[model samples]
Target: MTPDDQPFRPISVFTDIAIEARDIVRGDAHQEIPGVRVEEHQARGVRVTEVEIFEESAERLMGKPRGHYITLDVPTFKERDPELRQRLTGMLTDQLKTVIPQDPQKSILVVGLGNWNATPDALGPRVVDRILVTRHLNQIVPEDLRDRMRAVAAVAPGVLGTTGIETLDMIRGIVDQTRPDVVVAIDALAARNLDRLLGSVQIADTGIHPGSGVGNRRQGLTETSLGVPVIAIGVCTVVQSISIAQEAVQLLVEELAEDVTLYKILREMTPAEQRGLVEEVLGSRFQDLMVTPKEIDVLIDDMADVLAEALNRALQPQLDRQEWT
Candidate 1:
């Protein structure tokens, strides 16, 4: 594509860090960013894509930098296949272990970041409910038996609307009191593509800025801010309505490209221009809207179970996979 044909600005709509990185690495936009690396792997039926941003320069280009983003692209996270579930959980746990500092006995605090009352945003709280917290057990059990379990703590800090407190502030207080070695934060993310919604999970070593999915960015939870390593895990639960419309418009453009009369007019317009036209037609009211599947309730529950099982297995290495069930 020519310079005019290429999008002039980075698509600011997507919230999933991996998707943003993929767009850059694919030369879709910002091809000048340096020190970006990408690798792909497969585990059974799962497709794993790793995108590493190694420098601040690339970070400026992609909007997220200096972190390792691992994306698990599963066809459907709600599948009933036991073997597929086992493989997916194993893959997720393995990714979590890599980011977490090596200390099987270390104290970990898993912060579930979301509003439990909303199904689309309830992935974090649900996962927190399913986690096998051993902090209390460690205090009561003898040292011999306690060694079998890790000191893991979990909390579902509700959104600012319900609690009237910054989620970061509450987490900071808990971090100071519990003094955990690491923190694992989970939340639901927004995707630019409908295909990725409820079909992918992203894990990052660089912390997370909660509420970014819906454009309400809050103070980020990071090692620099919290004084401990922060691993963020999230699944894309929704996509912006404007983005969906843009995709549909692009498909229509492609289908009409072959027409002799439309070819010249369409060829003169860039993808960005086409998207602008679509947005103009959609109007401002629909631009701010977000879209999620009607079955988001069921999807969130299944994802929470999968993520919780993975976290439990990774935190407590001594426990067998079957023990999670």
Candidate 2:
């Protein structure tokens, strides 16, 4: 069928990664964006990008609230490389330290946000299991070591589908009781590109929208919503199926461009038109489909361990490197 005869309908790609949404429209990450600042750094085997969106205009453009986003791109984070894993964990720890408050007496609550039943969505609960909770341990540890420990607590409130309660509400109840100095949330995220899935970790001061990647938009776990600062850490674990298909269409268009008739017809369609055509071809059944890697089982475990270690190291800087305590 000619590109002209295809019916057009607008479609939107859902992504929880701050950089993915911004880069889509900005064309280049290095280019100046109004009300937004972009900085890039590389260390060891990881590539780090910091994007700060402080202006309302930029917030509207990026579809993210005014906050700081730090993304670590480590292609092998999901792989079994002990030395590299240690380095990445340290890097994640360093990045996390910058946002957390400097108060020595500070207490923190770490909320893992996802359904434990689902592996792709299980990243949160899995990481929570490994976090070092010192809130109750300070009394038991030797008196000399007590001062180095920070009160830490973690919970993995099952998703609404399972618990019949809002994740935010459950968290709110906990926050009211504990009144921690800060909150850290971990969840799986969706990315526009499959390459980023399980490869990038995004740390944001903007909190997080549970299930946003899957169109389940739950209440955001943010400062305004919970009355405490929230830090969200997520790894891209899925991609919208439509995003992959749309990119495939673009590649096909380029491949077939030598044919003048086809080239003329296809070139006339705007990017949105191409996306619409892709959406139509996808139909309703595939509209809600989200794709994840085949090796997600192993990947999630590897990543969860590293991230849990990073959280432990960051929240308790004085802990021995070899010990999570």
Model 2 agreement with the true structure over 213-305: per-residue lDDT tens digits: 778899999999999999999999988888888888777778887776776677678666787787787847676888998899999999999
Model 1 lDDT tens row, 79-180: 556677778888988988888765667899999999999999999999999998878886787676677778889999999999999999999999999999
What lDDT does candidate 1 reach at residue 45?
82
Best candidate (score: lDDT)? 2
CA lDDT, candidate 2, residue 271: 67
Q: Which stretches of candidate 1 lie over 4 Å from their true place?
A: 1-11, 21-32, 78-82, 259-264, 321-325
Off by over 4 Å in 2: 1-11, 27-31, 254-273, 322-325
Return the number of clashes found in candidate 2: 0
lDDT of each: 0.82, 0.85
Task: Write out the backbone clash pairs for model 2.
Answer: none
Enumerate clash totals for all models, in the order shown: 0, 0
Q: Predicted candidate 1: what Cα RMSD to the true structure?
A: 3.0
